[model samples]
Target: MDYFSQSIKQAIRTVPDWPKPGVTFRDITTVLQNKTAFRKLIDAFVHRYHDQHIDAIAAVDARGFIIGSALAYELNASLVLIRKKGKLPFDTLVEDYELEYGTASVELHKDALKPGDKVVLVDDLIATGGTMLAASRLIRRIGAEIVEVAAMIDLPDLGGSDKLRAEGLTVYTVCSFEGE
Candidate 1:
């Protein structure tokens, strides 16, 4: 990894057996707490997309909102939220995906994007790829083209990036934990 990526990775805290046994959660709150780390994290993304013609950033719910809002402002692009089912107040399009134990859904407002809009999907991490895939589907359903999927971290052992690539989506991450 590059210098900025290495520093950002170091700022992340790994919580073992989080929410359940055998699950190591890669928490980003630490990075956000460190001003320098946070700036590097955002700058890494801004530098990559500044030259690209990006219309909007379609971010996955909750965590994705954090990175998405900053990136949208930096790139001069609109921010579109792909939220948890029923969280959106408008007419929405929903996509359901499988989780480890059950299925969950994400929703995008009907008018969030127009046809031919170029969007970058943002999330804090890629684990199983379910949420990102669902969000990408919602973007396509609205006739917007996903320019790429961006994340701060990737747990490649979980195969999320591979799953997204299998569906023909480009995946970008600042750093990856290979066997976590």
Candidate 2:
């Protein structure tokens, strides 16, 4: 593994259960709190697509907002937020995605990205891939081209990358829980 990638894997904290019972939440807060690790992560993302023509970054809601905004600044690209329904203040394009137990929705401003804008979608982690898929649909609705789907970590056992790959979305992660 690369230096920064290895550091990120070390920074991930394995919480047995979070937000519910029996679900292990691989928290990234530890990495965020460590200045060196966090900078390495930011640099990792910047390094991957530094030469790509990115017009903006479509970052998922809540946790995604944390690094998404900073990433956009690092790349000097526009920031487009993919928020939960009723959260966006302007006219929006929303999508409902299915989860194992239920369904939830996400919304993006109608003007978040202009037609033909090259965008990179980012989020903190991918567990089931529902939220990111929903965000992708919303971005496509507004006519933005998704150059890549970037995540801080990928939980392959949960089928995150497989599901996204089925839809032809290329996924990149700084860390993986595939064998963990």
Candidate 3:
């Protein structure tokens, strides 16, 4: 990994057997707690997307909102939130995806996007790629185009990023962990 990537990797905390046995969870709370590292994390994304004509940022529920909002503000783009089915109050478009364990669905407000709006999907990490894939479908259902999917960390060994790339998406992550 390069210097910045290494920095990001160093800032992350790894917890073994989290949420389930044999599952190593990479946590970003460390990065969020460190001001310099947080800035570095956001700057890495802003630097690459500042010049890109990205109309909006559609972040996955929760953590994605954290980075996505900051990025949208910096890039002068709008923000779209892809949330859990009942979390949204307005009419929504829903998309279902398979998780490593089971299934889940995400929703986007129906009026969130205009036809042909260019969007970048954001999240804290890419694991099984199901959430991002569901978010992508939610965007497409609203007639918006996804420019790419961006995340802070990627568990490449889990094959999430590879699955997204196989579907023709450009996936960007500051750093990646080899094993899950």
- Tell me how far the alpha carbon of residue 111 in candidate 3 is from the true structure, in angstroms, after superposition: 0.8
lDDT of 2 by residue, 16-117 (tens): 867789888898999999999899998999998788889999999888888789889988999999999999888989899998889999999998899899
The model with the greatest TM-score is 1
Against the hidden true structure, what lDDT does model 2 obtain?
0.90
Candidate 3 stretches greater than 4 Å from native: none
- Runs of candidate 1 with Cα error greater than 4 angstroms are none
lDDT of each: 0.95, 0.90, 0.91
Which candidate leads in lDDT?
1
Per-model clash counts, in order, read 0, 0, 0
| Candidate 3 positional error at 3, Å | 2.1
| Candidate 3 lDDT (Cα, 0 to 1) | 0.91
Task: Give the lDDT of residue 97 in candidate 2.
Answer: 96
lDDT for each residue of candidate 1 in 6-28, tens digit (9 for 90 to 100) = 99999999999997898888989
Ranking by lDDT: 1, 3, 2
